[model samples]
Target: MSDTHLLICGNSFNDVDRDRLSTAYPAVYVDAPADMAALESGLRASMRAVAFKGHTPFGAEAMDLFPQLGLIANYGVGYDAIDVGAASARGIAVTNTPDVLSDDVADLAVALMITQARTMIRGHAHVASGRWATEGEIPLNRKVSGSTVGIVGLGRIGREIADRLAAFKMDIHYTSRSEKETPGWTYHNDVVSLAGAVDFLVVALVGGPDTKGQVSREAIAALGPRGVVVNISRGSTIDEGALLDALEAGNIAGAALDVFENEPNPDPRFLKLSNVVLQPHQGSGTVETRTAMAELQLANVAAFLEGRDLLTQVN
Candidate 1:
């Protein structure tokens, strides 16, 4: 295959994604980790970098398949799916497409907040189905302006969401790894306290073992009956069962979710809940942002091939 040193792993890559990357630098392609083993021995040994584009885990076993592999350029901001520790142990560099998609994800977080609070989806259905004409005016929805909001993580995406909310006259509160210098915003020592203090709770924590279930059952309980929870971060960041129990029992006002523990197959219970708003994890799915992300991923691969530092190396 032209002695190509690059390997692109992505079962999800469409014709456009494949063509765009393949055209930039000729490379071998594999849909999944298992398929990598099927490559010719010479071709496998020549691979110096991998451009990974899916949620599939790339562990040490997979890394071993490429003896000369030096880098793994992840397609998205979150690399929880890849075993970074395994890559590091094998001296493989890891890079992710960050800042490029932050604005899109952050914008989606804000959109979910507004959509949930205002019942915009229901309003659309009400109008489209002619219910507004027959049943009279739709019921009033909650106001987001001037509301108190608590962000679970004050990282890049979280900060963006908070900044936009500031324009809505929101009182922003957040709990981060370390408190930031933003003077007007309140900082909480823990999530329970943060949840109890706000009318809406937005989760923006990264996905990994360190943050797994950071938003605990107690935290969910603390949000109270009037609290609306919004999660745009990884699903594993929160306790799914606890959140569902709280929602079903009306322990919390409602929830607006863009990610789930099971992803495309989230709990069937969520499908039946009218109080919750659900999205198909399209936080960074915009054409402009996705194009930027792809370009960033390719840039990292190119850097590794050319003996240059990765633009956004994770490890």
Candidate 2:
């Protein structure tokens, strides 16, 4: 039997990094978690680690396939798709690439807020479609600078977003599990209060059941008309249905979303909205950030294989 100790899964990894992984270890590449069953015939029974990279549900059943598996190194910072409890029960360690992608994600969050506020997409379309000459000047858009902004979940990435927005001379309001030492910034005990206090609401919360739909209908309603929402965090962190309803009813002015409930193929409703700006969840898609994430994932896998301390171990 081949000593293929590493199984690389998920379609997010690029060709260069895939080649690097194969060259570094006796690795078998599975395109995605869903294809694991079909490729089971070719998988080495001695596989000890998995380099996971997608948002597929990898549970105890999948873990059972590799009796000797010891680690699941996630490519992204969010590992809610993986069953951490199941991994722990099987004596498997989990690690994710965090902090490295924080700045890039934060940058995108700020970009989305600005893009939505200024109606940049519409302005670009107006110029490209020759509507600028035919229809005269584009309509005035909202200003982002000096506006009051609310940040949901002030963790590592959240803090980065707040710091960048602060440079825009905006008032920062945030709601986290605990108050952070943010001088001059307002901290709300709840999301609704934070939403009501700001012109823009940016979601920076983590994923999982606890935070799923953390931005509820009440929060969206509290934002009210003229308020813009920017989300760069996981799709589940926001109540997509409430957001859609608000957009349709003009309860909220606009939204700039990088993540969605159905990513790469979000709701068709979002397509028709003129006030919304959509992104294909590319917050950390830059080459520099992606390369760092890949390196961190591989480092964790290598540590597990070499019986060294796992870098960024989750459980």
lDDT of 1 by residue, 1-315 (tens): 646988989887767777778898879899987788899988998899998987777788889988999999899999998899999999999999988898999898998999999999999999999999899987898999999999999999999999999999999999999999998999999999999999999999999889999999999999999999999999999999999999999999999999999978999999999998999999999889888988899899888888887899998
Angstrom error of the Cα, residue 219, model 1: value is 0.3
lDDT of 2: 0.91
Weakest ten-residue segment in model 2 by summed lDDT? 36-45
**Distance from true position, residue 182, model 2, in Å?**
1.5
Residue 150 CA error for candidate 2 (Å)?
0.6
Taking all chains together, each candidate's TM-score versus the true structure is 0.98, 0.96
The TM-score of predicted model 2 comes to 0.96
* Deviating ranges (above 4 Å) for candidate 1: none
Residue 245 CA displacement from its true place in model 1, Å: 0.6
**Tens digits of per-residue lDDT for model 2 on 99-161?**
999999999999898888888998999999999999999888888889999999999999999
